[model samples]
Target chain A: MAVTARSRRVKPAGGFELAAWYFMRISGLFLVFLALGHLCIMHLIHNVESINYNFVSDRWTNPQTGYIWRLWDLTMVNLAILHGFNGLRQILEEWINRAKSRVVLRTGIWIFAGALLLLGNYAILMFVKDADYLKNRRDASSDAVTVRADVDRGASSRHPAAVPAFDVLK
Target chain B: MSVYRRGLVSRLVEGLRYGGGAGQWSWLLHRITGLGILLYLVVHIWDTFLVIFSPASYDAIMGFYGGKIHGVEYPLLRWAFRLGELGLFASVVFHAVNGLRVILFDLSPIRAVGAQKELFWAVVALFFFIMIPVTFIVIHALVAEPTPVAAAIVFPRNFVQAFVH
Candidate 1:
């Protein structure tokens, strides 16, 4: 008698899954380092709350300073977008069945992610070129300062300047 | 002490192999990196927004990263910055490659299980493939040690300038 072959079920290997699993642990470790250094420098050491418009204008005015700032900015943008998109992709895989509509949904989501990344990068690049806006800002600030000084010196005090008074029923 | 009972480590390995499908593992990693990146972003933005508020604060921030001084004798800040750069580099590369795996899965015609398995190893391969030069540059930039006396003496001025610069 001939024996029929019995099929055995084989489980899938850890595809990108294992690597991804390891990535989280590794990235988490690094993030702890980056975050602490970042906080210490930004808040604790310098206490960045003292920053203002001229402060930014002066900082960006330096080429090296501008470059470093852009580097950090891009790094943040790229990492955040990639990580968020990948996470969203995982969610889709785990939850949605692999149907046509689901694939389309994922594609659409990825496109949106791409768009957001591009927009963010563009905005950061443009932020450095706002010198005109900065000048206008300076003028406005100076006017405000002058107005405050006048007020402090008693602009509305008893001897008001030969100010024109509005007449009713002229 | 029971012969029939398995240890915790063995149990975890078994669980990952069985309960944790390849896809699940990758998904877990994606979430981890995702959250890490998000956390980094919040602090990054907050710190950077300083450029908008104060120039001195910004300079102080940059200067901290510029170099590290140990008393008046040694500068050790470059090493720290290198370490940070390496971390950021790794994060971006891993996330980007893994993201590609995700994109492929979404686009591929393969079954769910098959896609997961294929992408897992693919991600690993791509990660190292991209990391080679990055690792090299980072290590070269960061690690510092005293030059041998003979070598240092032979080119004292040059060596001193090279290291300092």
Candidate 2:
């Protein structure tokens, strides 16, 4: 590949894009095993039919587990997301030659990445919070079967995000 | 003209041979895997966000793909899913391992093709060193069961936690 004028004009030397290239490799290397393990367990061993809210819930809530799933997913989602957006940014730069178009595309990418980051974090953290709700309810309602039952019902609610919303929305 | 230094067909064959060296291979794998992950990430982001609207809505999507709604685990679909899983596994591994090598080679003083070639081989060596056992664990979990095998190996979360704290 010769340093064609078009290529030379576009190449930004030694900065964020360069750093992002480095980050993609580092993050990708980590994602290899993490993603592979996730795929094996979720897709291979159990099969898709077996995956449900309950399945996801158990991984987050089981006595055998801890905050492991929550944090692993958090790291996985964020890293995958950041790496992906950076990679796309490069493609966008190449494809969208016009400076104005590049800016618009970059802004769109940022907005998209931000929305994903927000929602992904919310879903993962909501599960974590739900786990905490179960833990506390178990600890506090040891003697109260009725209370345990109620908490269980509430925790398992269609949108247990309702503890706040159920109060406000209702 | 420079881009097609060789004819298209010859260039394709040369690419298949990895004629440029490890650097070229890294570049190739990164683009392929990056696109692969990007596609999946788009769907994932959409699905994860669906939860905000309603868990039922999220379940509706999962139900279609995985058959989690009626507990109808379709056997035939399993093979398709398995193929996808393996593809994703390969993409993630290649992209990641090659990515680390890219970072290291770029950061180092050596920008020569010779260094890039050598660094590429080193990265491949490191990738295999880690991936062989990981491959076993993945296979075992796929074949037998995952709970004991996958988590029992490196258990990366705990390992990383210990490293961090």
Candidate 3:
């Protein structure tokens, strides 16, 4: 009696499946730590509403901020996204039984996931330049001050209790 | 009073006990959680893209995530967020630990169901072992600790001089 894998469709642990199996386990572990740490800081520690552009910008490029946050975020996104796409590829193989369908679907998946990876890296790395964040922060601060002043000068009279404190924060 | 029950629950339990091996269950969980993370990835990418194009829209979405709809009852949303975080944590832990077991068994020659069962148990043990401390640290930081990044980022002399002066 030979040892058999549960999935008959998977061609008895062939090279591609074998490599993917190994990749899933290894990348899964990396994603666990990276993603958990990310969620810990982003969600558990800080309320979701607290994560405004300023907060993200600060984490990304502020000299006063450690580079670890940016690095951690980028690494987590890269690993998790790639790992996820790979896992989906495996699952789709099981679901799409037809060879032609599998090829078409896998090709589409590769293109989409690959494009997403590039776009994600671009948005994360390029948008976080300190100069840009600083400029936005300056503009935001001025806006905040103006809104604060408006409320102080009886802007509240216009809308009884509708002063948008949401707009004006440091 | 005994170790067994006698209804649909017992049938289900017995079925699970006899039905599939550890590999099956582990594979099932891995697929589920992988899909879970992928779903999050799609939304996360869209939201992040919003940051570069429209800060206002990004803020609006963040407000939704944060459950801040201008004076609505919040306990439900808060609990929902906490529960979702916990589920995500559990999924990550299980996927990681069990995934290691899978690789070990796959690489080695041990394919016996008994050994696989033991591997599954080991994975469960490790998951709980790591998660207990990780969960504590996460929740503790959330509640009592000044955000961890603060200390990491702040320059000590600059801070002391500026604040002290």
Candidate 4:
């Protein structure tokens, strides 16, 4: 921790890193409950074996439940990217203490975090609709059967798991 | 060193940094915890997505999780997984409460620098306050559940049963 002639003293440019630090403590607390609650619901209770496309469709199609999923998705995006970007901010704070570099780095973090948030939100919104397709267990089961048959044929022919040229999508 | 010594603000900032003041350590801890939590989130999401592909597959994947905590079947991995969850929980708790503190700092309706002192203790207080209960619940849930519980608690069992059946 000593400053030598070769090592210059680098000070954090502003209070943002401090803010991020405090933010971590706060977010960390909330995340414990959120994540635990999430785990209990998704993994610990009835087990994933019970979940299917119909399971998801039923959940999302419910007006109240859909809002809950939407909220969870938003919280995930907000906390995750912000937390990540803040970590990067600390790195920049440590190594890139100069004002000009700080500006550029902060800008980059913002843009990256913003993009991730947008993508996560889009996925959640699309999921509401996609849940419909997954609801049809019969169709999904047929697809699974077809895929399995293809795999069996490939196994007999000594073909790799890769799909045949004819099966390739455009 | 000379530059910092020449100005009050510079020296104060340097003191805060090297002195390991509340703000300084909070900043460092924030970075550490944030990265930790972010890593957890990635895996958590991937695991959850499996439920969408197929329930059977999802069960097959998760079947290995949450058994007797001290067996040769990747007991170390299991312990590590629990520890990682705890670590992420700690990180999340600290970050969120501290983030609110930061927000208040920005608002600065009152004395700004004075509030920084309280913010530090608040982080510590918040950590211990939340940790005790979370640790209790997590331990009880993990150990007591001789059988696997549901993947999600969002839907009660009765509701799920009614819907799925």
Candidate 5:
């Protein structure tokens, strides 16, 4: 007896699913570099203990290379967020069978992702170094001993007990 | 005709028991890690946003992440969060490597079908190769110095105070 063969015709890829599929691969390619580089810088080159308001301000507000850092961050925020939520959308599509629920959830994901994207972009674009904070640094720079004392005094006075734990750990 | 629906837990259990080879396991882990990272991404954006919203508040929150609140230290919580970051790092490394395998398979399904197992192993190898040294550095950083916390502060005692004051 001979067995019957399954259908061999290929379905042409198009529509939202196709676009989404392409988007994942492309965005993922960029993220492999963008994200891994970011992790390397944050986790490997410099540990989290070193990161603080000053570190961020210096990186984002430096006259020489601030724009490069900002653009790097902006690209990372957009690609990573979009890529992540799109993956979520795919997962939801797989699990949720109800049409109405799927619609609501999809809309909710987009709205939520959109809001985060907006906030991230705004933060990157609008960030300005605090002048008062900078002035404190500038004044303290004249003397190394005074710098440490002044910063400790200033930080504690401005924001009581808000000093980072690294001081104690040190 | 009658239709029967199975619960999510049962389906997951069944999937776990069924032998679908490395491909299936990789697919499952991809989804798991992808979801985990997505969850992190949401909070990360918000935390970074706080930098502009209030700089002092941001620093205070960062202090809390470093496991100090009101000048008090929690070593246990700090270590726990650091380990969690390690896990996050592992997940990201795995997800990224496995994602490349997926892209490879997609690029040439006919050729890749035979190499799926090899591709999976390659992904695993790459993940470890990248993670081993990085893991050492991370752990060394944690032990040698009191590394600042990069993870979330679930209880925002200082976070709230930064806003109030």
Candidate 6:
């Protein structure tokens, strides 16, 4: 491949675009682990049916390991959102040639991404389990264990026993 | 003279017809999966945000996922969402694995031209290797509560069953 004058100039002048390219690869490497691990934990290891507000409360409020999860979620949110939006931006740039429309669309994309990032981070950082909810969650957590056991035993009728606990939480 | 502006759909159709090779297909899939995940991420963030501002609403929203809220059951909706989760899982796995292949080609010391096809096939193999067990687990979990006999039919008792149980 011949390196034309334009191609050579890109290295020195591409500045932000160059940085965005490198960021995509680096963050993508990090997310491969972070995201797949998240999927395994949330979807594979634990049934989605088992998740609810109390589940989130329990995970985020645990005394010993909550902070670790918070940090993990924080990093995943920032990296994943930025990498996704940047990739979207690249796609849009390739497809949309008009300069003014491109600028508008790019700004809109960032605004949406920025707002989501802020909201997600705030939810993680500002979460505090109320005493009443915490106490109920503790009780429900034990009930959840029992529900899992029953489900494992092929006792379909026992499944609804888990509903009242979620009802109480609601 | 009127100018005919090419839209994104036309451009995409044209690109599809061009038929470069494995590289083009991989690039197209990456774009698609990336977009799907991003769309889900936006919804996920908003839903989680509800937890902080409205706990009751959060629990109610989760009920839709589980097929019940306040004692009402929507078994069909739950199945639909579970299937959607399976699709999302497939998308995430492919994107992650293919992204790794792209990274290796771009950043690694190895020469990419000779090995690109092999790397792509390796990614496909790994994707299925991961998804097969995962699909079983998800379907098992979905049917376990409603029809234990069917769940058993879907997933025979084995070591993997023991792990999940």
DockQ-based class of model 2: incorrect
**Winner of 2 and 6 under TM-score:** 6
Predict model 6's lDDT versus the native. Answer: 0.73
Residue A5 lDDT, candidate 1, scale 0-100:
9
The C-alpha local distance difference test score for the whole of candidate 1 amounts to 0.48
In candidate 6, how many Å is residue A6 off? 14
User: DockQ for each of the predicted structures, in order?
Assistant: 0.04, 0.18, 0.22, 0.10, 0.30, 0.41
TM-score of each: 0.42, 0.63, 0.67, 0.54, 0.80, 0.80
Give lDDT tens digits, candidate 3, residues A59-168. 66656444666576678777777788877887666546789998898899889888888877777777744456547756765666332211221123332321122122
DockQ of 1: 0.04
Worst 10 residues of 4 chain A by lDDT: A161-170
Q: What is the lDDT of residue B84 in candidate 5?
A: 77
lDDT of each: 0.48, 0.59, 0.61, 0.54, 0.72, 0.73
The per-residue C-alpha lDDT of model 4 at residue A139 equals: 59
Please tell me which model should have the higher DockQ, number 1 or number 5.
Answer: 5
Better of 2 and 3 by lDDT: 3
Candidate 2 residue-wise lDDT at B64: 58
lDDT of 2 at A97: 74
What is model 4's native contact fraction?
0.17
Tens digit of per-residue lDDT, candidate 2, span B111-150? 6445766777777787677567655654553454223333
What DockQ was computed for model 5?
0.30
Chain B TM-score for the candidates in order: 0.63, 0.68, 0.65, 0.67, 0.82, 0.81
DockQ, ranked from best to worst: 6, 5, 3, 2, 4, 1
TM-score of chain A of each: 0.56, 0.67, 0.69, 0.60, 0.73, 0.72
Tell me which residue pairs clash in candidate 5.
Answer: A49-B148
State the lDDT at B50 in candidate 2: 62
The model with the greater TM-score, 2 or 5, is: 5
- Model 5 error, position B131 (Å): 0.8
